[model samples]
Target chain A: MLAKRIIPCLDIKDGRTVKGINFVDLKDAGDPVELAKAYAERGADELVFLDITATHEKRKTLLELVEKVAKVLTIPFTVGGGINSCEDVAQILKAGADKIAINSSAVRCPELITELANRFGSQCVVLAVDACETQEGWEVYLNGGRIPTGIKLFDWLKEAERRGAGEILFTSMNHDGTKNGFANEALAEISEMLNIPLIASGGAGNMHHFADVFTKGKADAALAASVFHYKEIEIPELKNYLKSEDIPVRL
Target chain B: MEKQNIVIIDYEAGNVQSVKYALERLGVNAEISNCEKTIRQADKVIFPGVGEAAWAMKKLKETGLDQLIPQLKQPVLGICLGMQLMCAHSEEGNTKGLGLFPVNTLKFPAEDKVPHMGWNQIRQLKGKLFEGIETESYAYFVHSYYVPLNEYATAETHYIKSFSASLQKDNFYACQFHPEKSGDIGQAILNNFIKL
Candidate 1:
């Protein structure tokens, strides 16, 4: 069976992991390599290192960080944030990243998806949609949930699939830090609507939330940050609960 | 210190980075090269792949590497899609393979998880890659299809039923799972490959 993936995202700033990762045995939890290794050992199916620091910094630093993490990790890792060109994808891939997630660049240049899929294959390219509820419906927000693209969530996902993105990492900006639960309704709707795998992101407060995302949301995977960073939820405990829930998870 | 001169065939497939990074981490010098001359002369060859089997094979053929690879004499390791392409034929895109192994590449039976993407255990280990890892230790996998267990089969794993987890034919060793992502067991496997 296709085991549901559990991913812990690490947001990188200035070449270091920010937002405090409180995994036991580490004094400072902000080191990207250390945090990544801990997550991998604890049964994270994959890891996403998103460069949140946007400046004149070259993608090299991120690649270097990826190399360091890949050294200790024995699982696929996806790198995102400010990936705008084929060269960026190539360099990241060369640095040991298994996949690349695109947001603003993909939305700005829809053809960029096709170009990447053509050059590097669709499975290597992931489309990330940051969304927030609106009067009309869920609106797509880019640039780390700051700018609204005025595109409907479902519509954008359909288009992303059409553009050849292998997977969709849909994040609910409204539920991002709420710790309430995932936006299940949105995720289920998109998962049913698209054939590509959907990775549910945002608002996971506990193990039950992860279970809810897979069972109710029908998400192929659930991604969280704060809950994992604060050590409020342990990945092994969550996986054990999910396993009892009949969700096939890697031990 | 002299580099090991590792060449990862750029058949335009995927997952080259993990292999390169894994090798470099093990202190075995590695570089990605697709040219026939460079690949043939390299100390070792690592063929890493991700993507459709047929399309990947097509790209290799277009680059004329489809013919050159079977002729190499050095140790060559294939990962994921690279392993699939070494089979006689693939059900994926209904394409022909390098015939390096006598097995057939096939899709998992209908309604049996389209992409078998996660950790699963292996049985009947009989290769350099499984040097120190205990039996049934899980390895990360991410493919919808697999190679049927046969004479060349070195290890087997079951998702729905038994299937080849690893295959070895002379100088060629292929793994359906991604050793680059399988944690310590994976690192041990890669280390074994490096020492080979």
Candidate 2:
């Protein structure tokens, strides 16, 4: 049996973590390396760095942060956002990210998935899908979940997998930032339909929500931003809670 | 403590940063390079990779690094695709490997659950890599192919079937799993490697 993965996602803006970390013991709220080290120390299975840098001048700083963060932790981490070409992927990977996630860029040019898969192995390629429920069905969105692509959610997932996506990271816009619960119904559908692992993201409120997403949602991994950033739920505590629920998670 | 020199071969196969970081955590200094001279001069060489066997092999040749490795007397560690590339040949792209281990790299049956992603405990631990480590310790793995269990098996793990989780032959060593991504247990394994 595979242990369910617990991943912490951070949005890096101007070489700093956007949602400031609230832990009293934490030395630097703006430091990406500090946050990642904290997560790894707390038993986070992986890390995600999303480039949301507001200023173009800070791009070099973002890469520097990636390198600095990559040095302290041993856990696998993925670098996402603004990776539009192979050159971009190469730079991020060189900067120390174990994997690369392409959300907006991948949707725009689906072949980018294939190109990356061909260059690197499929094991490190993550395809993130921002989906929202519509009258017809769940449709994918682009540009930080602001624009609707009108692409059928399930259809796009199938193509991405066909194009050699190792993992599909599905974030339900309806559930995102709402903290009500995960879009388990949608996740379960995608999990059953695909052979690869699925990471459910966006509506995590508590440890129970993580359990529900793993059990009810059939997600191989659960990712959250605000909950972890604000120190609402510590990763080790969550893993212990999952264990109490009989979930096979790495303790 | 004087740190040992470690070099992770960069065949453009994938990120060696995690491996480098893992070494650093053990108080060892490691460098990443595809350069023959840098690799040859290092105390220990790490061959880590993430790509198809055939394409990675092509890049190895293009860099003319293929001729430089395998001749060194120092211990060499290969991870995942690196381990596969060290074998006799891989079913992936019908590619010929370095023949360092004289074993075939095989893909799991397509019908079966593949990529064998995630944690599986290693039993029957042996050799320097498992030094001071308990048996049945888990490591992270993400690959569709595997090296069959043989006499060279240092550790064995089960996915579809029992396979060589780690191998040691002569001065060469390899692992099908990513020790760098594997946490404390992984760091222990790496520490053991450094001690060797």
Best candidate, TM-score-wise?
2
lDDT of 1 by residue, A96-204 (tens): 7888999999889989999998787777788998999988899998788878989888888898888788789999988887788999999989988886778999888
Residue-level lDDT of model 1, residues B62-173, one tens digit each, is: 9898899898888889999999998899998999999999888998884543456667887799977788888888788877788988988888998777989999999999
Please give, for residues A1-251, the per-residue lDDT of candidate 2 as tens digits. Answer: 56888999888777777742321122234678888888988888888888864255766787888889888877888888788889888877888888889999899999999999887778889999888998999999988778899899999999998999998899898888777779999999999888888989888988889999989999889999888888899888898999899998877
The per-residue C-alpha lDDT of model 2 at residue A119 equals 77
Give the TM-score of chain A, superposed on the true chain A, for all candidates in the order listed. 0.94, 0.94
Instruction: Provide fnat values for all models in the order shown.
Output: 0.45, 0.57
Worst 10 residues of 2 chain B by lDDT: B110-119
Candidate 1 chain B lDDT trough over 10 residues, lowest sum: B110-119
**Where does candidate 1 stray beyond 4 Å?**
A20-29, A56-58, B1-7, B10-12, B34-44, B52-64, B73-75, B91-94, B106-116, B121-128, B131-136, B148-151, B156-163, B192-196
- Evaluated on CA atoms against the true complex, candidate 2 attains a DockQ of 0.62
**Local accuracy by lDDT, each model:** 0.83, 0.85
